[model samples]
Target: MAASRRLTQFALVMTVAAALAAAGCASGLGGGTYQRTEARRTMTVQFGTVESVRPVLLEGTKTPVGAGAGAAVGGLAGSTIGHGRGAAAGAILGAVAGGLAGAAIEEGVTRRQGVEITVRLEGGSYLAVVQEDEGEQFRPGERVRLLRDGGTTRVTR
Candidate 1:
């Protein structure tokens, strides 16, 4: 019975880890989204001088992937604590705790901090945009380009 229970626990852990691994891989951890289409669209490019740079945080969304994966792993972990009724109770409690932790962990992992750049266009228009920092820093008086395609715009240096 003990051996059988241990085997079950191992299987549960492996399954949970495999499932969560896929979710983790699919997660937008780098913090950017881009839509691609085969149709060619005219892109509008404009040059501007940066006026100011301010730090900003891009919040991450909550998803069931984290909670579900966590609960499964936690339940298996908890089941090992005791036998019979005690084990059953442990698994239940563990699942609840694990789910919460997993969600919080996912949010933290996906959250990203970037800079919001304010720029003055040549036509005397002011535009503020946020772009992911690729280890590059932006400051006042920096020359940048705004590329607009369809309804999306990206500020690049």
Candidate 2:
């Protein structure tokens, strides 16, 4: 009975160890036997020059109008503070303050337009390039090179 009990305990321990080892192996802990892939891509890019620059106004912006209205209200309040000469001085000061506030509000709502470049790819596909600051310098109808990697992804030129 004693020998049989000892054998059973040993068997249980061995089974537990084997399970733990198998779990570790499956989780990529036993050895680094994982495959690595290279980052490869292919893309076509066209170059173009900046034709025009403009302000891209933000939508749903009420800053400028709100500022103007707020200014008017402030001016009216100031004008109320003084009689005659004081009222006139307050009105002038209020107008100046309102104009500055309105300008600031408008500036916040305005975004600078990016340069637009037009390019044609090999399959006659046209692409429009819009970039901030520096854009690809290619003239209209100028020949440009397009590069593609294995996966045929487009990269910036």
Candidate 3:
């Protein structure tokens, strides 16, 4: 009976952990992509010439979901190793280690390669925009377009 209960608990913990991870999946930040809310909204357009393009790393999100799921799974696995006080100590250690690993994995999975494009507008002013690379290449002196929606701006050829 005790073994059956433990198995059930383990299954439940795994299910919950998978659900949390799926919920935290990151969305694309590419130039061609648009969020649902951004559709049908008017954006101001401006013309520019690309002055420079540099590679960048876009950082991933840091959220509680990953840490929480890891801790729960680790604690459950640790508790099965010993009895009473020993089990408690093992759970604590396991949870700390699991939480750290989970956070690192989450960040690594969502990290993306990006580009910083510097442009000189028609008015002799310079502006820079960073966006996910998405296989789009830019060169110095190439003509580009800048689209602005509220505080967000993107560069496109």
Better structure of 2 and 3 per lDDT: 3
Highest-TM-score candidate:
3
Model 3 ranges with Cα > 4 A deviation: 1-24
Poorest stretch of ten by lDDT in candidate 2: 26-35
Residue 148 shift from truth in candidate 2, angstroms: 24
The best candidate in terms of lDDT:
3
Cα lDDT of candidate 2 equals: 0.45
Please, what are the lDDT tens digits per residue for candidate 3 over residues 1-157? 5986679487657846684566466777878878888989999999999999999999977777667767776776676667899989988987887777767766776789999999999999999999999998999999999999987798887
TM-score (C-alpha, index-matched) for candidate 2: 0.31
- For model 1, residues 1-157, the per-residue Cα lDDT tens digits are 7897788778777766765575555432221344446146787889999899888887655788878877887788787778899999999998998888877776776677767889999999999887655556777999988887756666777
Model 2, span 111-131: residue lDDT tens: 333344455665666655343
Query: RMSD in angstroms, candidate 1?
Result: 3.3
lDDT of each: 0.75, 0.45, 0.82
Once model 2 is optimally superposed onto the true structure by TM-score, how far is the C-alpha of residue 143 displaced, in angstroms? 18
lDDT of 1 at 4: 76
Model 3 local distance difference test score? 0.82
